[model samples]
Target: MVFQFDDLKKKTILLFISAPLVGAGIGFSFMFFAIKNQPTLGETPWRTYLNIGASDESMLQKAIRTRVGIYALPKEEVIYFMASTDSDGELLTSDQRYEVSGIAPATKIWSITLYDKDFFLSDNALNRHHFNASSLNVEQGKPFSFVVSSTPEVGNWLPAPQKGNFALCYRFYLPPASAFPINESSLPKIKKL
Candidate 1:
């Protein structure tokens, strides 16, 4: 049998159509896994703290941020710290009690917000979802500490959901110029109790 020009044209058309679909599928899979496995700045297997740059984010970083649905302010305007685990490297669960302690960096205002594993505000009974610097009970210019648990706690308590894993989002608004170049050392420490 002899090959015909019609067969060549049909194959070429099929290639043109199927190539993009295959490429798109592979590209999407790669992006999904890339974003899933990408490590944050101060990340261990259990804890992750995202460190976003001011104006120097890579394309992959920007895509990951977008995928996570984070509308981060310019680094000069705000800084963020995120954690989903405790110092002992355990996933933060509603049944476990945790404590976070640190001084608010020299910023105009700071807040700690709680979110469920899906990044929605945890449905807490106290109707409280966050604690800000203005709401904290500071002692003589000393560092602040707060407890996170399903139970009620006294003094700077952040309520965790009744069930499932949760995360914390710490934000500093209008931070001083000196607050730039943040690192894990400057953030609070979370420990399970």
Candidate 2:
């Protein structure tokens, strides 16, 4: 035995069921788009989220910043640039070898850290994932370089995951105002070799 509802009751039921579903779909898409095309400020391969950790940041920007595990510092104090590709715009993967060379600007400190696709340190035997001002072969005001590979390298080996993709984050502490829109060439050059 089946009983059908009147038009008004049926409309109410439909709204109840569809409202949440529609809202959920809209919300998920909004977040996904925001996170995927996340507003950043830079050229290809290396970009920094706009207003990340800034007082005037939108909620979405703050959320993206937190998701990426960046330490909150006003842009005036610190800035970060992330790259997931080589110089020729190739997606950086674990299987390839790369030579990363750069000269740090006159900041309090700087570092280059490697992260897996999940935005965490790549797992490797050396337990090494980054090289910073204090941990490089070159001195301040000089060019520094390193290698990113799954296999051990001669010097400055920032490990890569054995079987997945990865990214690199360059952080500058107490960077000067002129450092805005950090120059692409100024940042480490990741060349597939």
Candidate 3:
């Protein structure tokens, strides 16, 4: 059977009108699931919220560069706060997780954790992997770099979800910022590598 031009036009209009209703139905379904299921960090991933650009390359390098008063925080003081950072376009596989490593000369304590899109600690078996500054076996002489990956070789690592995006949040307390440039250099730097 063949449809005439006028019949086709009517069909097209009907499809257009029905399309929005279909989409609304799907949207409502998602909202219901979101309310009922309540996704977790690894369960839904968090990389979707990140935005990176090469235009800011120089600016980022500048942020990483050493500057005056960069490490001015008091070493004897304990500052408690959770700071979040993002990775470029580096996608993590299901087998991968997160690992953060850094050195503190005189800091009494420090930790890095992963959170879901909702800004809550990831709901995982390990209860959100976190390693204190003293608990880490970081190298000496220079600031340490931690690898937040799904499948890290060894050292401090945070397990991620099976297949979804995620984020990192670092908390420093009584950090040796005066001696180290963590404040100036930004402890966690996102990478696509």
Candidate 4:
């Protein structure tokens, strides 16, 4: 039998329609396996806690090797630095406490937030998940400290959970380049509490 143009057109149309479905199926299968087999943060050096022989100079290298993304700050940028469970070398308990601290440039608004290993803010009844420098308690010209404990403290207390380990993520937005450069050296050092 001779092949007809109509048959060819129909087959082409069918392939076009079916290709995406097959591709999607394969993509989802791959993603499922990837997620299932993902290595725990502890299994890799990059994922290991920070502050292990870490200083301001070497901190950026640690972040890069671990794929911890940091953006360059803007000129006249104000930086908020803090330490938390995400800071370094400390295993956090759901019931344990932690804190992040840093000096803000005498100019901009700055805040710190705590996130679980999943990178989402903890859901709590109080709705108090972040601490801003302006709103935090500062005793002297030094960096302000926020307390992390299972029990709430008087100032900037972030409640810890009772179930799993957690990582505290800090964000320094709107930083000026005058003091804190746009380079990696400008990123704040996060010390694990």
Candidate 5:
């Protein structure tokens, strides 16, 4: 024998079956996109994922690598921080211009790379995505500065997409032990200008 429900009952059953699915979908999407977490090793807007490239990498870091496709080295060799906000804890949006200034970390090599909300190199007319110690203008005992904006700037312009959010990745290669405890002052300051 086959059992059939009335129109109202059918609709109610459909809602019951789909509601949790919809809720779970929303939760999963948020997890995939933002992957929110408290700062583990740095102040506002800067965070270091511990145990990266090791056998016991944290679950959060694993998910981040999967989402961003980041290829990280061992912790001793590479200490990297990814910042999605500014010094004032404001989300880094492309619509606004920003000044990124800081003293370079003493390491074998280092770079500050910018990625769009989707964790990919933002496509812009300038075709610039990252600035390394070698590429940036580094003078003896002087701080470096750059402008991050969609429009062209006078010097050291890192083109940002016109809309949506962005993130900055600061990676130091073969860094010294002192660099492990990254001084907040040493990290590049992201100030909306």
Candidate 6:
């Protein structure tokens, strides 16, 4: 086939514009899926722990972490356990009620905060957003338990958006040495009711 100079220029221009658009689409798709499906570093069946390493994170891992809002903090100083689903492996929605139960162990402090699917605090009638060890009224030698739901509940209620998926961030500040190498037993169980 014979090609004219004018035709070739038009094709080149089309290639230049479309190539970036295609590349960008693919890049965005990859990033979205990568972050969405990325496995947690130290994951149990109910909860997942993010291993914010001091160094040696790949570019894709870093991108995923950034997208998920994993911030800078020394592992020894604090540990984070996150859950977006119930023990039944169902995505957590405010339509159902959930219970999170576990002993705090001997940590300096611990807290559980509720966040919407977008990782922002949800707006609700109750201004309450989080509950910490200090704020909770725990009887000595008794395990701690809390309810997560859109409806009001007795005792340690963590509010959730009335009509969307939500997540829980369990933070242990200045955790003890035994808290390292977390396992299912060490983490709280989140069960849907």
lDDT of each: 0.74, 0.78, 0.46, 0.52, 0.79, 0.76
- Better by TM-score, candidate 6 or 2: 6
| TM-scores of all predicted structures | 0.78, 0.83, 0.42, 0.48, 0.76, 0.85
In candidate 1, what are the lDDT values of residues 85-172, reduced to their tens digit?
A: 7765578899999888887667647888889998899776789999877788553236988899899988778999989998888877
Per-residue lDDT tens digits of candidate 2, residues 115-143? 99888887778778888988885666688
lDDT of 6 by residue, 60-157 (tens): 76776677756746668777667787766688898999988887656747788889999999887888888777777664235888899899998788
RMSD of each: 3.4, 3.2, 13.5, 9.7, 4.5, 2.6
Better of 2 and 6 by lDDT: 2
- Candidate 2 weakest ten by summed lDDT: 36-45
| Candidate 1 regions with alpha-carbon error over 4 angstroms | 2-18, 40-56, 139-141
**Rank by TM-score, descending?**
6, 2, 1, 5, 4, 3
lDDT of 5 by residue, 1-193 (tens): 5555687798999999999999988867766656565463455578776566778766656876666546767778787788889888889898899898888777638888999998788888878998877778675245788888888999799998889999999887887777655676677888999
**After superposition, candidate 6 runs with Cα above 4 Å error:** 40-53, 139-142
Model 6: how far is 9 from its true place, Å? 2.3
The best-first sequence of candidates by lDDT reads 5, 2, 6, 1, 4, 3
* Alpha carbon deviation, residue 92, candidate 4 (Å): 3.2
Q: How far is candidate 3 from the true structure (C-alpha RMSD, Å)?
A: 13.5
Q: lDDT score, residue 79, model 3?
A: 38
When summed lDDT is taken over every stretch of 10 residues in candidate 1, the lowest stretch is 41-50
Q: Highest TM-score among the candidates is held by which one?
A: 6
Please give the lDDT score for candidate 6: 0.76
Candidate number that wins on TM-score, 2 or 4: 2
Candidate 4 lDDT by residue in tens digits, 43-107: 21112122323345363344342443244342234232323334354566665555545555343
Superposed model 3: Cα runs more than 4 Å off: 1-102, 139-142, 151-153, 175-182
**Prediction 3 global C-alpha lDDT:** 0.46
